[model samples]
Target: MKQWIFLVGAIISEVVATLSLKAGMDNSIFYIVVLIGYVLAFVFLTKALKSGMALGVAYGIWGACGVAMTAFLSHLIFNEPLTSIMVLGIVVIIAGVLMIELGSQAATRKEKGNV
Candidate 1:
């Protein structure tokens, strides 16, 4: 449970860092913040990964969550478009990630039962 929370935090931190990287294009101070955020994010992410989370499942969750949040943040911060196609793509990505997580869990459970 705690690892899940850490995973989410890591994704949020990564998104913030990525967005800040863009916003910091002309400002050294903003760049510094971006660097710090990225470092801290990775630190927590590695901890989560080391805490018994499967690599594929963890990464899928991170990628999907980051992509979705990044898109929303882009729209809110940079006024990027929120077209239907974009929304659809995000939905698809999220669904796929969820399937991967679920599938892996089911496989693990089945393997455990067989043992």
Candidate 2:
């Protein structure tokens, strides 16, 4: 449970950092925010790993969610287009992440003789 919280924080932080990249390009303050966001993201990610979340599962979820959130937020914040094709791509990415998570859970269960 705690690990999941860390993972969530990491994902949100990464998304914020990524989104800030655009604003940071013109503002020094945003650049500092970007740096802090990324650093905190990695710190939380490390905490998640130390808390026993599998690396593959954690990283897959983080990357997928980060990409999806950043894209959606970008559309909102920067007036970027979110075309149907891009939406489809995001869905596919989410699906792939789900598959990875399921696979990780199955592998863990099997190792624990619960499968």
Candidate 3:
């Protein structure tokens, strides 16, 4: 549970960092935010890894969620248009992440001879 918290933090950090990149284009101060956001993101990601979350599972979730969240946030923050196809792609990304998570759990259970 703690590991998941770290992972969530990591994801949020990454998303913020990515958005900060766009903001940084206009103001140099936002560049500082971008750097700090990325650094904190990696720090939390490392903590999640140290806490025993599988790399594949953690990375998959992080990347997929980041992409989805970034898209949504861009739409809200930048007034970017989100087409139906883009929304469908986000749904597919989420489904894939879910599949990865389920597979990871099954693998762990099998390793423990619980399957």
Question: Which residue pairs show backbone clashes in model 2?
Answer: none
Q: Give each model's whole-structure lDDT.
A: 0.88, 0.94, 0.94
Q: Candidate 1, overall lDDT? A: 0.88
| Number of clashing residue pairs, candidate 3 | 0
| Every candidate's CA RMSD | 1.6, 0.8, 0.7
- Model 2, residue 15: what's the lDDT? 91
> How many residue pairs clash in all the candidates, one count each?
0, 0, 0
| Model 3: residue 102 alpha-carbon error in angstroms | 0.3
Model 3 error, position 29 (Å)? 0.8
Give per-residue CA lDDT, model 3, range 1-115, as digits (tens): 9999999999999999999999888888998889999999999999999999999989989999999999999999989889999999999999998999999999999999999
* Residue 78 local lDDT, model 3: 86
> Using TM-score as the measure, what is the rank order of every candidate, best first?
3, 2, 1
Clashes of 1: 0
**Residue runs of model 2 more than 4 Å from their true location after superposition:** none
